[model samples]
Target chain A: MNSTIARLTATGLLRGWRGLLLALLPFVMLALALLVRMAFGIDPEITSGLLDTFNLDTVVPLIALIVGTGAIATEIDDGAIVYLLTKPVARGRIIVTKLLVAITVTLLFAAVPTLIAAIVVTGAAGTVTWAYTVAATVSGIVYCAVFLLLGVLSRRAVIIGLMYVMLWEMLVTGLVDGARALSIQHWGQSIAAELAPDAITASLSLPVATTLAVLVTGMAAWFATQRLRSLTLAGDS
Target chain B: MTSIHIDRVSKWFGHVVAVNDVSMTIGPGITGLLGPNGAGKTTLLSMMAGFAAPSAGTVTLDGDPTWRNEQIYRHIGMVPEREAMYDFLTGAKFVLANAELHGLSDPGAAAKAAIDTVDMQAAADRPIATYSKGMRQRMKMAAALVHRPSVLLLDEPFNGMDPRQRMHLMELLRQMGSDGRTVLFSSHILEEVEQLASHIEVMVAGRHAASGDFRAIRRLMTDRPHRYLLRSDDDRRLAAALVSDDSVVSVEVDSEEEALHVQTSDFGRFTVRLPRLAADHGIRLYDVTPADESLESVFGYLVQS
Candidate 1:
């Protein structure tokens, strides 16, 4: 990966009210978990339930989506990505570097927050908070990879990514049990179950879920590079 | 000593043709790509810069294919026509980023040299979003130059610059060209091209119309048989006096319209001779109009000839 491109990408993500606004999402999620705990008191069953439902399922994927899509879409839209593209660097290196930036942002904004929220609810019992943090990290990697590909592939990446999270993840997976095997949330759930065997559980086997997540993330990374190599500037002829 | 060779290159988007079958060899010098708007000049430059691939033929730099080639950028630097840059970064930071991207051994020194070359050191610390059009252009130049590529390609590089900035850029390009770095810039403005470029490649209607020394092509455009319709108090008398001179190749006195269509071989002498001939013949000159003065028509005449 090219460090200059990664540094530039990170600079873009961390600057402006965008960074402040995205930071707000995780804290707000953690605050809600704290409020729920104060109201109901510390019960592993209910605490894990809150962490799984609100922090992992909803918050991680959404924050990952924002960071991932923002990584390259804004530059591509304004044509500033030309600075990176016109250099003597390999296209794959640039794509991977940008993906690195997006994943780093997701780790800070989503995964770390998931751990903190888990602690506020259950106080780190049964290694449950650590398991959910690992789960959040895995989900962030998968979601960021998917959304980064979408950002490079199309101009409507944010809209399309939101639809994928809201409609396909919620509606389709909720309705069709077969769809769970292909879902990112299910993959994270499986991993989380394996990590915290006594506290958390999932529907799929460990091998199938891990393999799907790994395969999809790798394929997204590959396609993002290939698409970036063929990207052309659109302008007046 | 780098050269770009575009051999019979053509680019088309769906049904619209941008650059038709065109061929040219641009060596180490300032070569102007001259054409009016929508004449496919940018498409040609884009191909040279490796931003777009030609649909039909190939564009090569020093015998290696340009399209889909990342290594070529090591020796090539491009300033695209669009003004969009990373606006959040300061000018120095932006150029330094470009230098670092090129894997320059001493990126800081290179960025410093580049910014100083553009005479923008004083404003290098300012964010690009706060720069004026001319300053932004110079910042882009600094960035492009930071890598010290042997070849430089700029599209509409003088679009929004004031006269002072334009002259500064022209001089900078001239110095680069003199240093044996291949420099090519595209301009629709004839005067800008004429004043700076020693050689010119003219594109008209997506086709390569002419290529040679700028002054020679200018002469060709001037020397092409100019058809002028003259209306005066005495058209036949003026025609008689105009034909008496050698500069007037053929003079047609239209009795029906009461005008004279005069075709001249020597454009320079003909204009000087007109008023003198009319005055000498005791004729009142009502009007003198060049019938074909539009740029397209001039290019069309060149294409047919």
Candidate 2:
């Protein structure tokens, strides 16, 4: 992966109000955690529910959508991608570099905040904090790669990504057992199940979820590179 | 010297053929791609730049196929017609990013040199969102030049520039051409092409209409039958006198408009002869307007011919 491309992507991400929005999400999550600790009195049950429902299932995918798609979609929309495209570097390298930057941003903006929130909500529960952090980090990386590829492949990437996160993962997976097995959230929660006490539901086996996450991330990244190689610059007719 | 060879290239969007079987070799010099809007100039340039693949045939830079070939960009620079650049970045940062993307060792130095080349150093610190159209155009030029590619392709480079900026850019392009860099810029304005380009490739309705030295193209343009709408105090008398001249092919008197529709075979002689003959015949020539002087008509004449 090219460092120059990553540098360009990183700088571009921080240059506008979009950067401010990304910075704000984590603080908002921390505020919610502090409010919950004060009002709800540091209950482990409440902490697990908040971490599972809000942090892992909702906030992680939302931040991934913003950072992942923002990394490449803005460039494509502005036509600034021409500079990167017309270079001697391999197209896959560019895709991988941008994905790396997107994942880094997701980790900073999404996973770190969820970890801090976990610690705040459950005082002295380092395992809970670490488990949820790992889950959010891994899922955020996979989501970022998948959605970043979506950004390259489609103009309506955000809409499609939101549908997958909200409808397919949250709605359908919550209802159907088979659909849950296909969800990124469930895969992440299955890993989380291993770290959490037996009180939380054991969603899936650890090996299955870990293997699926690896496969999805790898396939998404590979597909994105292929899509980018053939990405057509629409003619101004 | 770097050259772009478009060999039997045809690009189509479904059933609509944008460029139809176009074949041209652009060598080391400044060549103008002259065509009306929607005449496939952008499509042709896109294919050459390797952004879009030709539906048929090939676009190559020095023998390497341009489509799906990222390495071709090492020797080619492109200034696209679109206005959507990275508006958030300062001009210097934008050019510097372009330099770095090209893998230049000293990106800062290359960016500075490119900014200086386009005389954009004065506004390089401002965000590109704040730049005027001319400043943005020059910045785009600087970005394209940051890598110092041998082949430079600009699509409608002077679309919105003021006169002074236009002249400055024309001078820069001329210098680049003299330095043996293959520079190709597209323009619909004949004067723009006539003033700068030593060679030109004219496209009309998705076909190569003509290609050669500027003078040859200029002659092809001027040598068409000249049509004039003449309003005179004595339209009938003017027509009567003008019809007898061998240079005048046909003269019709339209009573409703009280004007003379004159078609002349010799443009040079008819222009001077029309007014002088009216003066000698004691007729007041109120107006002598070239009927078909717009670019569309000129291009249409070329297509028809």
Candidate 3:
């Protein structure tokens, strides 16, 4: 991966409203954790529920969606990507560098905040705090890879990504037992359950969840690079 | 010297054909792609820059296919028509990023040279978002030129520039052409193309309309049937007198408009002889206006020709 492209992608991803949105999500999560700690006072049920329902389910995917799509989609939309595409650098390298930046941003804004929030709500760094942090990290990577591909593939990436997060991850995976096998949220939960058996439980086995997460991330990254390689200049003749 | 060979290339989008079976060789020089709006000039440039693949045939740089070939970019520096760029970065940072992407040994030095070439060093440290339209355009040129590729493709590079910027860019392009770099810029303005390019390729309605030097294009435009609305004190006598001239093809007197609609075979001869013949015959000429003088009409005539 080219460092210059990665640097540029990182700078663009964190600029203007996108940076504000990314910064705000983590701040909101941390604030909610602090509020819960003051109200509930170190209860295991409230801590686990907040980490699982609010942090893992809502905050992680949303942060991933923001940074992942923001890394490349805005450039593609505004026709600014032509400058990067015309260079001697490989398209695959560019996509990889962009994905790396997206994943890094996801980790910083999503996973690190989850770690801080878990500790904040629980009043300690225990199995529960570490469990959700690990889960958020892995899920952030997977979600970033998928959404970065979406950014390259569609102009309406954010809208489509929101549908997947709300409908598929939140609604369908929560309802259907079989859907857990294909869900990124479930994969994170399964990994979390393995780490903290008392606080978290997962429908899918850890091995299956781990394998799917790895497979999906690799496939999404590959497809994104391939899509970028064949990108056309925007606008009509 | 680098040369781009478009071998019967055609590009279509869904049901619309943007570029149709165009074949041309652009050698080391400033070759203007001249056409009116919607004439597929951008489409052809897109294919040449390797940003779009042709639906049929090939675009090659000295024999290597440009499509899907990242190596071709090492020789191509493209200034796209689109104004969008990494506006958050300073102009120096943007050009440096481009130079680094090109794997230049000293990106800072290259970026400095490019920014200087575009005469943007005073404002190079400012964020591109703060730049005016012309400044943004010049920074874009700096980014494209940072790598110093042999082939430069600019699409309407003078669109937002004032007269001074246009002249500066024209001189730079001329210098590049003389240096044996293959520079091709697209423009619809006749004077712009006439001023910068020694050779030109004209496109109209997705088809190659004409190709030659400015003088040759001028001749093709002039050689087409020249139509003029002539209002004279004695329209009947003028029409009758004009009929005897070898340059005058046909003359019809329109009584409603009170003028002679004259179609001439030779533009130069007719323009020279019209007033002389009118003075000799003592038929006072009140008005002489060329009816089909629009650029679109000239392009249409070229397409048909």
Candidate 4:
């Protein structure tokens, strides 16, 4: 991976109001966790419900979508990517580097905050916090890969990504039994259920979820590189 | 010396043809791509720079296909027409990042040298967002020049520059041309190309219209059939006298407007002979406006020729 691209992508992602938006989600989670701890008083079931429904089901994918699409989409929209594209560097390397930046941002903003918020709500160390954190991190990688590819392929990546997370992953998968197998949130839920069986429900087995996660992440990243290879810098026609 | 060869290159988007079956060899030196706005100059340059592939032909640098060849960039540098760049970083950081992306061992020094070459060292520490349009254009040039590639392709490089900045860039391009680096820049203005490029290629409506030395192409543009609207005290008398001149193709009296519409075959002779003809005919010429002088018409004539 090229460090220069990585650095630029990171700086670009963090400097705008996008960075503020990312940071705000974690603070909101922390504030809610603290308020719940003060009012409801150290309930493990409440913590599990809060972490699973609020953090994993909501925050992780949202942060991943914003950071993932923001990492490359802004550059593509502004036509700043031409400087990087017209270089001797490999296209695959550029994709990998940007994807890594997206994943890192998601983890920092989504998973780390989930871990801290779980501790605040539970008031004790347990498998629930670690389980959900690991699940969030895994789901974040998958979401970032998918959304980064979306960013490369479409100018309306953010809108498309939002629909995927809200409509398909949350709404449809939550209501339809068969659709869970195709959902990113279900894969994370399966991993979480493995660690803390009583905390969350799993539709697919651990082995199947792990395989699908790895396959989707690998394919999305690979497809992104292929798309980037033949990207057209269309003039202002 | 490096050369970019576009062999029978044509690019079309959906149904609109941008570059049509155009073939040319841009060898070492400064070559100006002169065309009117929306004449496919940007599309042609995009294909040469490997930013877009030609639909029906090939663009190669030194016999290597530019499309899907990342290695070709080692010898090619491009300054795109768009003005958007990394706005948060200082110009120094941006150029340095470009140098590092090229995998130069001494990226810092190369970036500094490029900044100095563009005469942008004074504001290198300033954020690019704070820069004027001309400064941003120069920073774009510095980034493109950091790797010191053999072939330089720029699209509308002088769009926003002031007079001094334009002159400085022209000098820099001329120096690069003399050093045997192939520099090709696109411009719509005739005087801009005439002042800079020793060689000129003209495009009109997606077709390669003319090519060669600047003077030859300039003559071709001026010698096309020129129409003029002449308002005189005696329109019929002026039309009668102008029709007798060897340079005049046809003269018609517009009774509604009370003017003479004269089409001339020779621009130089007709412009010189119009006033003299009116004076000798004892007719006072109020206005003599050269009609059909738009760039499109000038280039449209070349397409037909």
State each model's CA lDDT, in order.
Answer: 0.88, 0.87, 0.90, 0.91
Tell how far residue B154 is off in model 2, in angstroms: 1.3
Could you give the fnat of all candidates in order? 0.63, 0.66, 0.70, 0.77
DockQ, candidate no. 2: 0.62
TM-score of 2: 0.92
lDDT of 1 by residue, A1-237 (tens): 888888888988888877887888887887888888998888877876677777776788888888898899988888888788888899889878988889989999988888888888886544888888888888899999999999999999999999988888878988999888878988988888887877777868988888988999899989998888777773576
Q: Compared with the true structure, what per-residue lDDT tens digits does model 1 show for residues B44-161?
A: 8878877788899999999998888888889998888788898989999999999999999999999999999999999999999999999999999999999888999999999989
Q: For all the predictions, what are the DockQ values?
A: 0.59, 0.62, 0.67, 0.82
With candidate 4 superimposed using the best TM-score fit, by how many Å does residue A166's alpha carbon deviate from the native? 1.4
The residue-by-residue lDDT of candidate 2 on B184-275, one tens digit each, is 99888889999999899988778888888999778878989989999988888888899888899999888998898999999999987887
Scored against the true structure, residue B221 in model 2 reaches a CA lDDT of 84
Model 3's CAPRI class is medium
**TM-score for chain B of all predictions:** 0.93, 0.93, 0.94, 0.98
**Chain A TM-score, structure 3:** 0.97
After superposition, the stretches of candidate 1 with alpha carbons farther than 4 Å from their true spots are A43-50, A197-201, B225-292
* Clash pairs, model 3 backbone: none
**Residue-pair clash count for candidate 3:** 0
* Worst 10 contiguous positions by lDDT, candidate 2 chain B: B296-305
Model 4 residue runs over 4 Å out of place are none
Per-candidate TM vs. native? 0.90, 0.92, 0.95, 0.98
